[model samples]
Target: MRKSVMTGVGVITAVVFTGGGFAAYNLWNGVTGGTRAAAAQPSTVATPAAKASAIKAPSAEAAAAGAKAFLAAWAKGDFEEAGRLTDRPEAAVAALTAFRTALTPTALTLTPTAERPQAGAPMTFRAEVGLPGAVRVWRYESAVAMVKTGDGGVVVHWDPTVVHPRLGAGKALAIRPVSSSVPSQVVDRKGRPVGAFPSIAAVLDQIEFADDGAQPAGDGTGVVVVGSAGGSGGSEPLFTISASKGAKRQLTLDADLQRVAEAVVKEQSGPASVVAVEPSTGHVLAFANNPAVGQNRAFGGATAPGSTMKVVTAAALLETGLTPDSPVPCPKNTNAGGRLVPNDFTDARLGYTFKDDFAQSCNTAFIEAAQLRLKAGSLPAVAKDVFGLGLVWKTGLSAFDTDIPVETNPEQIALAYVGQGRIRTNALAMASVSATVQSGTFRQPVLVPGKAQPMAARTLSATVLNQLRSMMQRTAQSGTAAKALGSISGAAAKTGTAEVGGQNPNSWITAYRGDLAVAVEVQAGGHGADAAAPAAAKLLQLGNSH
Candidate 1:
């Protein structure tokens, strides 16, 4: 009996030890290889198909509950909660934040409307936000769709406002009141008033903003008053002016030359504008419009400058100790920031001096000069501060803002050196540059003299200016600008043809003859010599005759 009891105890001991060993093995597996065990197991959870069939469609009450929770969270600044309620939690947080930032106490209120569940898809909810303090209440409607997740939670699949509203066509914001009074009289450098027709208010109404409820002044005499209709159905004049108080002076513009420029532009295309500025005093002598009178693009239209910007590049190079005699490699094509820089105008090319390159409008020559020879830093800043390429110059009568790309990348700088990329300037401003070069001092170009402040001071040295003048004269005498105004005595000019697709490209001729400096542009014209130079020559002759 004693022996039997010992045997039984031995067996029990073995069994206990084996059970403990098995438990220890499981604990070790759980710590080191839990992922493997989990992968090996066949999950009893339902598949996406099974879940779709098993889950009930969301009721209207549930959708409303979700929307209310979302809005409440949003109003309370609980972005996380709001996101949790919407399909796009991250986007929901961002949208709610943007709405909060934009909508002040004066802003509108948002209210949710209908809720519907798609048969096999997610549930959708709708809402509207109304603008209150505005003259007109602008309403923005939004919709959101929610879907069930595998984790028994809901996720938004479609936030229509977040996705579609940005893509949808919508009207621009209501027009605001004009800030300042329209200039009535444009006076000359001699203090003589320009010819009076109508105030800018009247002209803008006739041209661009008539339906905005601008009213002409009563009494039908000298000045015109612009008024807006008040809420009480009465016209409240926003501005008042006297027309006959200023002297009626005439511009130096030749009607015949202006018509010829218009004809050239029309022959090329409908979308074109021309500006002629006197380089001596920066007076805008002739401004012409193509596509008739309604399409006014002379001062406002912004197009890529192309190679015309090389003038600034040349100026920069000259300022940085590079003379016209500087030697630069005339590569057929060179890589600039991974882009191939090539000479576009001519096929027959050779080594060129800086002067020859500029007169002939060589792209690669300037690029090489700007990068390797000049070694000038910050071309865009120089263009802005020196050449005033992207400045908003107000001519007292009207104003246009220049658009230049503020990119600092190598590609942008390389392209900008050749007047490609996003460099843009109006004809008036371009004329100012020519005037600056001619006068040996930068003068703010103005339609009405003394109306604008005088230009600060001379930006370039007289020696550099003379060098540029000489090169420009050579350009007129034998280079690309030779055909147009070359034979005209005492004319120093530079012509540029900027490539714009499908059109003839923009042509420019800026020159100075004796005392008058002029700048002219022909949009979509074949070449500066063929199109813009003739107009410039005629205007120069007219100015000289006067």
Candidate 2:
């Protein structure tokens, strides 16, 4: 207060001096706040805690819907649809299509259980497909594993089961007896045991009996004696039959001829089936698939008859008053349902008499004579009744259902006359036709040899039969089949080439020597002459020699 009075404040100086510098101290404190008090206030903005993302669990309904759609698509052979439902769509389509093509199911039932949801994961389902009486089911299962993919779906991964582990490594499980009563032994025509009748325990080494246990008989438990002895400790009665137990009798099949035929078939056919059957007796002499054993093209293979079926048309026409000598005008091309039917294989127009047409395998001639000229409506029935083209014979072997797809239209009939329409037959059925003509009656083709039984007697008139035979003879001598039967004496043959979808044709030749009727087929090969006829010639030579 002593010096401040005059410095800067005149009025404040008196108050400041009186207050003993209290005002001045207060102002100084406000300007520079205390650091300690400010630091004591709690932090208003807090640091965020570690965040965790919430995962979604798949719904059972969605998973089930996917599984159902997958199965339906699989059944319909729609691979693409099936794929979309799977986690790995591309892989699923490929695997499913392969399964569909490989497995032929008599019955298929798929039952998918409730979806089992994994913890914080996608849902999954279980399905069981029952394949009863499967030959290689175990192998199939081993090669394939049920797996759920990352996206949430199921698939089968191949894992084949190990074959016979203990008794025989390579061999499959031996047939076993389910009951102790001893099932009747299977015997061949010669009274030989067709195969080993070892007790299931004997072949398999260890077998569990059914709950009923063994049946009681005169001596000990009534187990029918199997193998070399009856349980009675006596030598098993050897029936006077020349057959022995557990022995496979060598068939009459000529192994050398079979090799040649198989080789030729492999060389010529592209994914084709070849079957050589004894037509008169229906004995399947040689059944071979082009690729090898399992392709199943011979009896099961089905294809359009093409012009080769004209042989049946010719026969049908002859049955209905038209003969090889019947004067039927063969135009270069006959109009059929807006499409022109040309004369001969070249699709060229030519004038052919009935015989010329038959020898040349003329489509226009046969069509004009069979469908247009003759009783058109009667052709199918005539084919069924006379030639047996659509007839399903009881060969006691698995066969494709032969059909003459019902044709009510003129175009269809024309196509049928040339074997291009709905008409379909397997090698066995076609051979039966040839055999019927040769034997003057129809005999069921027999694969398991025993006694040949007649399914039906002669359905064609003797005159019709003779005329057909004569025409076939002419075919062998100078027709499309002439070269096939050229060197063979007493061999009457007809060669056929059936056209398929832009594929190499199916060749067929059926011939008979004395009691043996043979039908030879070459698929995806050349004409009947090059493919089927050569095989027939060789077979005829072998049969004649025997």
Per residue, candidate 2 scores C-alpha lDDT tens digits across 198-269 of 111111111111223222211211111122211223222211112122323322233444554566556653
Stretches > 4 Å off in candidate 1: 1-218, 221-233, 236-269, 345-348, 373-377, 501-504
lDDT of 1: 0.52
Lowest-scoring 10 consecutive residues by lDDT in candidate 2? 3-12
Each candidate's clash count: 3, 15
Inter-residue clash pairs, candidate 1: 87-156, 279-517, 306-419
> Over the stretch 1-546, how does candidate 1's per-residue lDDT look in tens digits?
000000000000000012111110111111112343232222232223322322444545454454445544443344455566654455455444333232211222333443333443433322222222322223334555554554555444424243224322221111123232222333333434432321211233222111222232222111112122211222223222232233233234434444444554555443555566655566666565555434456666566656656667788788878888877657687667778877756463566888988888788888766777444345665666766655566564454655666665777667778877766766666666667777766656665434454454237777777888888888878888788777887777777777766676777767777666655666767667777777677666655333
TM-score versus the correct structure, for each prediction: 0.56, 0.57
Q: Which ranges of candidate 2 are over 4 A from the true structure?
A: 1-264, 347-351, 450-454, 544-546
